[model samples]
Target: MTRKILLLSVSAGAGHVRAAEAIRASAALSGEALEVRHLDVMDYVPAGFRKLYADTYLKLVAKLPALWGYLYQSSHEAKPDSTTEKIRRSVERLSTRPLRKEIAAFAPDAIVCTHFLPAEMLDRMLRQGDLACPVWVQVTDFDLHRMWVHEHMRGYFAANEEVAFRMRAAGIPATNIHVTGIPIMPVFGEMLERQICAAEYGLDPARTTVLLMGGGAGMGSLDTVAQSLLQIGGDFQLIVLAGRNVAALEALQTLAAQHPGRLVALGFTDKVERLMSCADLVITKPGGLSTSECLAKGLPMILNAPIPGQEERNADYLLEQGVALKACDAVTLEYRVRLLLENPAKLADMRNKARALGRPDAGKQVLKTVLGQ
Candidate 1:
């Protein structure tokens, strides 16, 4: 029988959506007789509520990150019967009506969720006899948070075995969990000539190239990072990816114009693999997909300011694994860059660690496990 798979993701961050897309892309390349569909789980919500949810989240993260951190920590430790969990369950139940309606229309054979919101909703639905298909939850973070826990989920996918061990310790059955790493598209792991990539991107091959990124939504003080790079006394070039943020792109373009031949500014483009292939290091926020892509490329990372919650945890994970350096400020960033630039040995060590951690075949592993192939 031909199986249908519905991949659900939320747009709160780009990683979840990108993970879903990667899974779909991987499925397409598998030559399987499977029907795959991707859905933005948030699209099922009413527009007004969706806008309010997104705006409030961005505002809180921007203006009051400490509060977000407190809430994130508090929620992570919430018990099944805790007030936070109850409240979250109530909200998810109400918000998922449209999702239920869409599910009725699509009637997929199996469901895969990259974000916790939809995963929790579907879990609840299954318990209530609203859903009958198998539910696969692919966590997009390196660290496991309490919100992802659900008694009814059939499968759980983690970025690494440490996360899987945590899941096992949390009372989830060991057989239900798989350490597949995060599902990133395989293109990131492709071997390409660095000089050719540099030439194609108009970057100088002789210079130490740094790729500055803030994920797909472009959320960071990237222009300041670019200006700080100028302070580091080195022969280097910067390729700044100001992903969907037009204002950031414009500001960075102006900065690049001021420092001719030293910086290249770009908006969101599909050519990230080629760019990362040509760069020696990446300075960016440690979102799950971006970090996985960096690891797949065997590139060293300097984590700039991360968001207060999951990203902070992801940064810590990368640092603990010796694949990345965390820079809390412009001075620290400059020092880290100078350290890597001056000591090729350290740079190579970090790159080797990243290579060891890379899971370029993660998407395939995930699909195989989910499909029981």
Candidate 2:
């Protein structure tokens, strides 16, 4: 009999959702044995609670960024038995009931959760002896957070060797932690011909193409990066993704008007893989999903100022792996980007390093766990 496989994920920043989609696509491809679905589980949470949580997150990270940084640092310093963890557990107790109800209603043979919320809910239900099937949690961040670890999970799919190591340090059984890189949609992992893709995108084959990304929310220092890149005068074209920030997109549109064909501004796009494939160098903030996507494309990364917490750790991991370079300031970023553009050897080295670090088969392997194989 074909098993119903439901991939559960929240839509906080598009990372978890991206992973879930990737998993669903692969699970669907294994013939008649798997019927797969991907859903935004947060939609089941009370609308008010969801909005408040998302809004507060945006406000804290955008308006009071230092406070957000402080909290992120504090989480690192927090012991397993911290006060925050106590309150977190209490909230988990209350919030998991709806999730439990949904799982019972759906009655899926296996459940794959990409975010901590669904993982916690499944863990809680299983601990209470109410779970009905196998549950696997795919950790999106390169650094594993305590929120991602809970008793009763069947397995954990991790992004890298470091994340697997961190999961073991967090006391998860090493045998249960699978080192699959962050699951990205198959497009990022596709064997696209780079020269053809670049030409189709109206980009130059002989020159370096740099992809400048704001994060999922399209949030970053775009104007500064754009200005800096333009100042460097490299034989390159810049493709900047402004995401959903209308104001940010409009601002870049205005600036691109001054630079002519050197800059191309895009709003929220489904063509990320297309852009990534065409680019030789990518400059962006170090969000885990974006980093993973760049790694999949085998493009060298020049990291701008990374947000605290997971993104900072991702930047450090990639830098340590020789897959990426970090720019301390905009001027330094421009200088490094220009120098790399001028030298094909350094670019080739980084490209090779990035490709070697990526697990292109991660999405495929994660779906195997989804099938209980």
- Using lDDT as the measure, the top candidate is 1
Tell me the tens digit of each residue's lDDT in model 2 across 59-173.
7766776787788777656775888777866765565567667678878988889988788777767888887688999998888777788878889998888889888998899
Which consecutive 10 residues in model 2 have the weakest lDDT in total?
88-97
For model 2 the local lDDT of residue 367 reads 82
Candidate 1 residue lDDT tens string, 128-220: 998899999999989888878888999999999889998998889999999999999878868988889999979988888999997777877
- Model 1 / residue 348 / CA error / Å: 0.6
TM-score of each: 0.96, 0.93
Measured by TM-score, the strongest candidate is 1
lDDT of each: 0.89, 0.81
Clashes of each: 0, 0
lDDT measured at residue 133 in model 1 versus the true structure, 0 to 100: 94
Candidate 1: residue 212 lDDT (0-100): 91
- Candidate 2: where is the Cα deviation over 4 Å? 76-84
